[model samples]
Target chain A: MKILSTLILLVALALGSAQAQKFITKSGNIRFFSSTPIEDILAHNRQVNSALDQQTGDFVFRVLMKSFQFEKALMQEHFNENYVESDKFPNATFTGKVTNIKDIDFAKNGVYNAIVEGDLTIKGVTKKISEKGTFEVKDGKVIGKSTFNVLVEDYGIKIPGAVAKNIAKSIQIDVDVNLEKLE
Target chain B: MKKKWLIIIGGLAAAGIVLALLVYFFVYNKPHKDYSKAKPDFEVEAIAFFEEFRTNAAASSARYNGKVIAITGQLSSVEVTDEQVVALFEIDEGMFGSEGVRCVLIPEKAETLISIPPGSTITIKGHCTGYNETDVILEHCSIAI
Candidate 1:
């Protein structure tokens, strides 16, 4: 009877872990592009932290603003100090749920169209957004990619009038995350 | 006499423009830190560093974020991504199983990666990216031999 009790306890613990199906990626990629008559600006941040819950269809992504690197050191410095104000607002985060979670099979090896609705916080302002994304499940990994455009004025990021010609009113952002099942 | 004054003013304006261009190209546009030779601002054991961040994330970030730090600890794991190499130092495993400090190395200059094995003590220098979940991250790391 004692041995039977121990077996039951072990199985219960195993089932508890299996129920928490979470996939996470630490080194995700985020890039932003802006085009103007004068110059085109581009920046990338590789140390993006993100996660997806398989059971709940919940998603979250967080990135440090200062981690973004640009080709020109001056541009990077201006982006942090003047534009994003990294000292006051250090990180940008997104938290939302996938609406079509039930339509896609987690165990299948194929690409599925997904819609994510969430709140994106940048420069201390939070805005609700929904965007189309691609979810690919293959070889024990989940890959996600999406592209969207955001207006700088909505987030209260102002481009000074003196150099306004060097920047665009809207910026295009690209996100790619390759997640592995949490073990 | 008027022509002489005009020539002097033109010459001074030209010199000012040249000076401004030189400063823009040489001073403001240069790289900020020479990480290959810059000394670490703070040196501490890996376990203590991780503990501080885990205990209080906000205070720890204010003290260490964006700063170059040196940490000594046992190598836990080495991961090579497509763009860079990341080394995790084992501070302590949680009741469940979570790691501690994670340092990402410069792919080009990570020459000392071959010598250190898992569980061997080593020192590394890098820019701290603050704490996230079970990790205290650093980027552009260089191992100290």
Candidate 2:
């Protein structure tokens, strides 16, 4: 009986520690910009959900397509109806891992370069992406930030010839999230 | 007769230019909807709204996504930052974490949202973006009460 109790206690402690290593944020921010000689377009989405498991170096993000806000109503409508087709594909998700998780100490308060490789799905098309970003740990909170470029054609987005000059072929995406301990 | 035709052609060209300019400004530079002042398309309780998404995400998203909605529920938590203010109405315990309706309030409602404590029932009106499998996100929310 004593041995069984000891085994139970060990399992409980293991689960507790595992939970401590998880960090999450439901209000993460993602901004994308398209620049062209004729016109520049920008959109911001703040209702991003992200989770990072420090133990396994896994990071995931779920972004609602309709949440992206543009400066002009016409651009927002076109982006949803024509570009991304938000009605058909409502979410964009990324599931990736920090490949160099061993180099950074989560307990330390500093910034560390992180290499993340994962699958990004947008408008029902999935692509493998490898990008570099920084993770800053301060006062037990983790801030993950990265900027990367995404090709419009790679995601199956086709710009019409009439307004091609107004939109860039490549869009720059910026991700900023402050993650808190799950417990 | 030739001079009259030239003047008529010039007048038509000037009118065409003015019409094109008006169309460009009105169609291309239209402003975004003001969610704060917009009427809610659907008003529902928080739990029921969340359950619909949890049960049939695709169907619910098709019906509610990109629409203005009003939801009433007990506030589970409030997160405030310099950039944004968010109020959560937790509906269930999911694999990632607590999942429910997450309303990102407009800047004008920051003070009102902060004053309300957790467990108090309140109504929020905003633009329903869609369910992210974890939470039904609403942007540009304002306190309906």
User: Model 2, stretches more than 4 Å misplaced?
Assistant: none
Please, what are the lDDT tens digits per residue for candidate 2 over residues A78-98? 999999999999999999999
What's model 1's lDDT at A152? 95
User: What is the alpha-carbon lDDT of model 2 when measured against the actual structure?
Assistant: 0.94
The lDDT of model 1 is 0.84
- Residue pair clashes in candidate 1: none
Residues B1-145, candidate 1: write the lDDT tens digits. 9999999999999999999999978865688565647899899899899999889887888898878999998888787788667888866665224568878888765657755787888888988867765678887888875
The TM-score that candidate 1 achieves is 0.90
Residue lDDT tens for model 1, A112-159: 999999999999999999999999999778999999999999999999
Q: In angstroms, give how far residue A49 of model 1 lies from its true place.
A: 1.2
lDDT of 2 at A38: 88
lDDT of 2 at A176: 98
**Model 2 error, position B41 (Å):** 1.5
